[model samples]
Target chain A: MKPAIDVVRLARHPKRPTSRDFIEYLVRDFVELHGDRRFADDPAIIGGIGFFDSIPVTILGHQKGRNVKENIRRHFGMAHPEGYRKALRLMKQAERFGRPVITLIDTPGAYPGIGAEERGQAEAIATNLYEMSGLRVPIVALVTGEGGSGGALGIGVADRVYMLANAIYSVISPEGCASILWKDAGKAPAAAEALRLRAVDLKELGVIDGIVAEPGEGAHEHPGETMSHVRKAIAAALQELLVLDAETLVQRRYDKFRRLGAFTLDDGFSELI
Target chain B: MLTRLFVQCPQCQTTHFISFFKSADYVCSRCGHHSRLDPPRWIKQLCNRGTFRSLFANLKSLDPLGFPQYREKLDVAERTASGWEAVVTGTAEIGDMPVALAVMDPGFIMASMGSVVGEKIARLLEYAADRGLPVVMVICSGGARMQEGILSLMQMAKTAAAVRRLHGKRQPLITVLTDPTTGGVTASFAMLGDVSIAETGALIGFAGPRVIQQTIGQKLPPGFQTAEFLLEKGMLDIVVPRKNLRATLVTILKIHRTRPYPVRRRGDE
Candidate 1:
């Protein structure tokens, strides 16, 4: 029988692609960039220019450690404020170099430790948010695993956003939602359903652009299939987005984001936010 | 007998009937889960009668990304959740003081701050500051809008800059934290309010608790980042229940209504 497949296990324990794993899977030659320019380099978030399928693309993503010691070193894929700043730096670099930006979002979110905030965590994330919207590059973001929150959103803004079939994206986790709503986290399944967090659900809800097909069951089942699907989707999306001239691409990107989750009331009944 | 609104119990799968109006009066009975209420109902509950003028009332959403059938999906969500975008900005009178109010429309995408919502808020904050009005923002967000891409994150700086402007104008900016305030919105202006207040039992944090625990590979303490935790950590000044929010705002506003109003002069001057 196939191994017992828990989504969380797939998230935490799959013999999966590390951030560098994409270098081989997607990029041909990666020129690594380091540091926030204001401070020391953060190993947690690896970013730079790379050739994805020979298409010069800015490859940026979060790197988590495989073992306990590395996970600690990487902050368990939770980026510090500088990590985000580094991403912002690389994105701007891509803009300067006139390269299409492809960001792989794998972090749970930005680091929330006291040190991160003390060093302007909020400011870093805020600045990225500000600069990225106006950057002149075709951005295609993929949530390969856990797109937890702003940490994911840090590198997550793109002309086209895709999520792996088993990947989940939500403002918060279902367990957190359950604790908040039901006061009992055991009802996480209910919270998960209520959150509409699966790639399919998010795509259906118009929250995500598309869901890259995974291997049978989930991404963990067929790693090669998942990687191939991601590759194809990225190729197609980049081709589509790169067709537009810089101004049109940027404007379209801006407008595309300006409109999301809009609805009108039919009667006096309740509505979605 | 008042027909109870069919509230999906947060506990059991069964839907419990509660008086729509009265249950709207508070949280759910069976699970104590906060029932979703519209911005209008919320404003009515918190503001003086006939006192609100909504800003950006005509700011319709436009699809910039052209996600296929996005409009239809929006239609379904709007019908189901009953609000536009995820935030409603306006000027409202509370306890005879005109305050700029921005309430998260939780029914809409967990009150995610998309571009329109962020723009509306920034504009409202600017308007309030220009008018020298005190601002009261009730934040109940899941966070920045995923669909809006980088535009949603921009709201963080825009709103934060507006808040800083309000501070420069010497106007009070009160942020009321509500359930599920996480992600970009909380990491930005939501956490930057001058006098932060939270609803009882509200979840207030930058990232979700589960993500943190997962990242750290540890079990989180009970009530790790709730309103109580925030208050204890000095992130919040007060924690008020929904039932008491209006009176609390009135009391706080009355006590701090000096800067916005023209100073009274003595005859000696």
Candidate 2:
């Protein structure tokens, strides 16, 4: 039997999955896709088709390495413009095949290096936003861990969005936020609370559709249980979306975002009432 | 209580002495200018008469994040300052040519790019693209709104993408970076203009010089990331003063007028 799991330990000590572990555990019968066609394939974003309980789906995710060498190999999940282009390519393929796209969002955001900008990182992300809004297939994105800036949102637009309990989805990191707001990095926790970045807060704000239940307090406690819950949630979401036709799905997707912040004006004459 | 009458240029920070009650109109002595101009006033200065029509005038912000004391703070700021958000964007005519004008309201939250600001800018770009109008954005900001958090930062991408769509269509996007533009907003469309322009003495940079210096453990050079420095370094095409902004924009728009609207060949369109 596996060692007795400590919930606190699992929550407190979170680590990223390795390439092999991610491939073997999360993906079954996976077929790796390659290239942006215009440039060489970026190792930052790994995407293709796979099966979850015999249901075919497209899996797109940001990969992080276990060690220094592997981290360098994956550019520490920092993607070039081609990385976004590759994901774009796979998304188009998924649409063509009428498959639901399940994206695992885990990145510090797109690479902001000089090279990425020269190759039009901004342009690539813009293209994705324009193209994804019109995609025919259902998309369901999950924030398994960190969802950083445009890098995460580049592939994160979906009919239903889910986040793991302890995961964070933010435009910028807490440290970055603290630095910007307070001019001090030590105030990160203050920034974190101010950012309202946790899954719970996002769920409250309608930013996230749901929170995928993790095992024994967190995903790290049992990877198997976490993956199972994620698969089930995504499958259910996809099933619900698939019932609608393409036009309805598109309209629903548009309406979903449109209705996110529905509010009515409160006139200054409230005291008269 | 008598408020001090001072006319400090947003660009140069040059204080022009003026008597508090001399001009109720608040004109600067040295520069012969007003310290803060309303959006309509700026539009009138840049565009032909009666050409400007505001877009998304009905869109107001919602405190979705439930920011601590956000409503109270907003109310206080509203009471003390001009009744508007960060930016006002819409279609207008500069001389004979139809153009889109986006002017930042620095009086409001330091002209931070919150959701409404982002949405307005995006809609302006989309409208320009649809109608084949040239876009001119007068950027002045201390960057994203901390109260809005991630949503505010998303505006960086949102605005950049909106501008990119226009650019892809071969539409001209003229960014006139004004004083104190910094952070994520500057990192995006503010720097991605087809023909980038700046007001003389505007502070334009990804991060503030002080912040960058403290982070990098090095002293910044004199006039680092200023409009004059950026022009010398090729990040900006030209640096026009507040007095010349309207005329310079007209000439730039006129020069690019010869190019025909790009054919829509991209599949997404």
Worst 10 residues of 1 chain B by lDDT: B61-70
Q: Model 1, chain B: what is the TM-score?
A: 0.86
Off by over 4 Å in 1: A1-8, A262-273, B1-52, B56-88, B91-183, B188-269
Q: Which candidate comes out best when scored by lDDT?
A: 1
Quantify how close model 1 is to the true structure by its C-alpha RMSD in Å: 10.5
Which regions of candidate 2 are displaced past 4 Å? A1-14, A18-23, A34-41, A50-57, A72-75, A93-99, A112-121, A180-184, A243-246, A261-273, B1-41, B69-81, B98-100, B122-136, B140-143, B153-269
User: How many collisions between residues are there in candidate 1?
Assistant: 14
Give the backbone clash total of model 2.
0
lDDT of 1 by residue, B204-244 (tens): 77766665665557677777777887777656789976788
Deviation in angstroms for B219 in model 2?
9.1
Candidate 2 clashes between residue pairs 3 or more apart in a chain or in different chains: none
DockQ of each: 0.09, 0.20
Give candidate 2's whole-model lDDT: 0.71
lDDT by residue for model 2 (B168-244), tens: 56789998887777655675667777888887667776545664554447666677777787777556789876667
User: For residues A55-94, could you state the per-residue lDDT of candidate 1 as single tens digits?
Assistant: 8988888888777888888877888878988898888888
